[model samples]
Target: MHDKTAAPENQHLSHRTAWLRAAVLGANDGLISTASLVVGVISAGGDAVLAGIAGVVGGAMSMAAGEYVSVSSQADTEKADIELERQHLANNPEYEVEELAQIYRERGLTQELSHQVAEQLMAHDALAAHTRDELGITDQLQARPTLAALSSFFAFLFGAVWPLLAAWLNVTFLFPHPLITIAVGTAIMLILLGGLAAKMGGASVTHGAIRVCLWGLLAMLATALTGRLFALVVG
Candidate 1:
């Protein structure tokens, strides 16, 4: 008697995991880069408001271009791979079936059952069966160029807004020396972003926060030194 109720547990879950990884990575990049940019600009003696606005605009455009190009390239490669797999399947169905059966056998299935499972899956949906079992490709996480680009761009811009707003508020009314205030605000914000990212990624929150703060400080220091050196030379 065939065990009709038995369903493969690992396959579908793996697809979800892949998509989560991509999304989390995208969001993390957005936060770190935007924060660093804003900090650098503020440290270079730019007015806090101007620095904030520039960071928002620059981060958004950079994210969009970067994400679009990267994900588009990945999507193209995936398309090519799929096309190749399709052609291979068409040209050599028997060999393809055997290959899938072999994969199942390698995964601890007996030869007879593996053959039966592969044949049954192929009969229902040859392309899907090959995509999953042979190519390890899943529909859920199939790269969408536009979606990835838009999400990255907007998330970066949104993430940048916090530090920008802190700078603006500090400069406008709260602080006599806006640079110091902005620096402090930005450091705190970086720590928060890092902690959030670490939590989501299942990492050490303190370590991530400290790492981000250190990088932001280094970038800001470099920019500040450059600005001072330029001023000295010009004067």
Candidate 2:
């Protein structure tokens, strides 16, 4: 007999995993992409304010749309799986029970114990039991499309603001060399963002920082090249 008191603890862990994954992914993408965009535009001699605003707005919309589509698909798949499980339970419950029993048996339970466990579980909540134990579906990991979209959009907006601030301050004539100031500020911010993401994800901070910085550099280089080409063509 499982201790009912332990359910909350398990649920909390699952929830943490889901939210943490989404938050980290959102922040990381926001930092990397927004920084890259601003850096690229600045390298091309674009107005800092315009570059920053464009980066923030574009990144937010992209993140929201991408997250919505991805999470919606995930939710759809989960729904389909649950529906299939429901059908199987309705059409061939005996077989489903046997399947559940076999799963328990594989986990070291004796055949008799497995059968009893499956029976008790099915009696209490058949769908929940099969969805969890058999299908490995949990309420915590269930994707909420709307929540995912909102979270991603907001998180990206927040992360993108730092770069925008750098650009805005550059435009205010506060910095001696606005471009250099923006570049340096963006580089430091990217390093910080990467380190934060790595710490959260239990990854190497150095590697993450290097990866982000390299991408930003690449974006700047590409944009600068494009700008020079255009200037040449116009001249």
Candidate 3:
């Protein structure tokens, strides 16, 4: 009797690279940008809630649009490569087979085995085998523009909402030093977001947290100075 137990599937992070990148970038930018906007407005003695609201909305839309356009471009390139490969396979079947076999040879397979494997694979599905092996295109890593755009939009909105909420709470309770509260809250969120991103990417959580915090601090500082200068110039 043959054992029919299923093999365990490996969970590789490469498959998540496309969407993960968009989500992380969107969230990080939204948090820092919105927080910076609120900080700058507060530093200029303006209404924090109003600035936070505007920044959150505008930032989320911008992130979504940017992600969609960029990912669409990547998808286009992939499509073009696939079409070109199809043409090559149609034009010269023998050369394409040799090319695929050469790829296998370079990857450590013996010449005899490589050619055999290539021939068998081509017989089964020539385009798929070539696209995957020669062109490095796989269904797992295909770029989906709509998915990326939605991920970015939601992530940005989620990140921006935190700072907005923090500002609103500060104002509602009449905090004497609202800037401190907003800044601290934003920094905490940034650290947490960084850790979460790093965890998903299989990297050091502490390093990611520290790195994002530093950048967030610098962005807020720059914006605060700009607001101060603007206030000084106008008022």
The most accurate candidate by TM-score is 3
**Residue-pair clashes, model 2:** 0
Ranking by lDDT: 3, 2, 1
- Model 2 deviation from the true structure expressed as Cα RMSD, one decimal place: 4.6
Question: Which candidate model has the greater lDDT, 1 or 2?
Answer: 2
Worst 10 residues of 1 by lDDT: 10-19
Alpha-carbon error at 143 in model 3, in Å?
Answer: 1.2
Candidate 1 structure quality by residue, lDDT tens digits, 1-235: 8787888653453433544444544544544555455555555555556756766787778878888898899889888988998898899999988988999999999999999988999889888888877777788757788987787776676666766776667766776765565567767777876776666566788998898778776766676676566556654
Ranking by TM-score: 3, 2, 1
Which portions of model 1 show Cα errors greater than 4 Å? 1-48
Q: Record all residue pairs in model 1 with backbone atoms less than 3 Å apart, i.e. clashing.
A: none
Clashes of each: 0, 0, 0
**Candidate 3 C-alpha lDDT tens digits along 1-235:** 7556864565676556646755776788889999899989988889989989988888888888988899899999999999999999999999998999999999999999999999999999999998899989898778898887888889999889987888898889988887788789989999998988887887899999999999998988998998899899998
lDDT winner, 1 or 3: 3
Clashing residue pairs in candidate 2, if any?
A: none
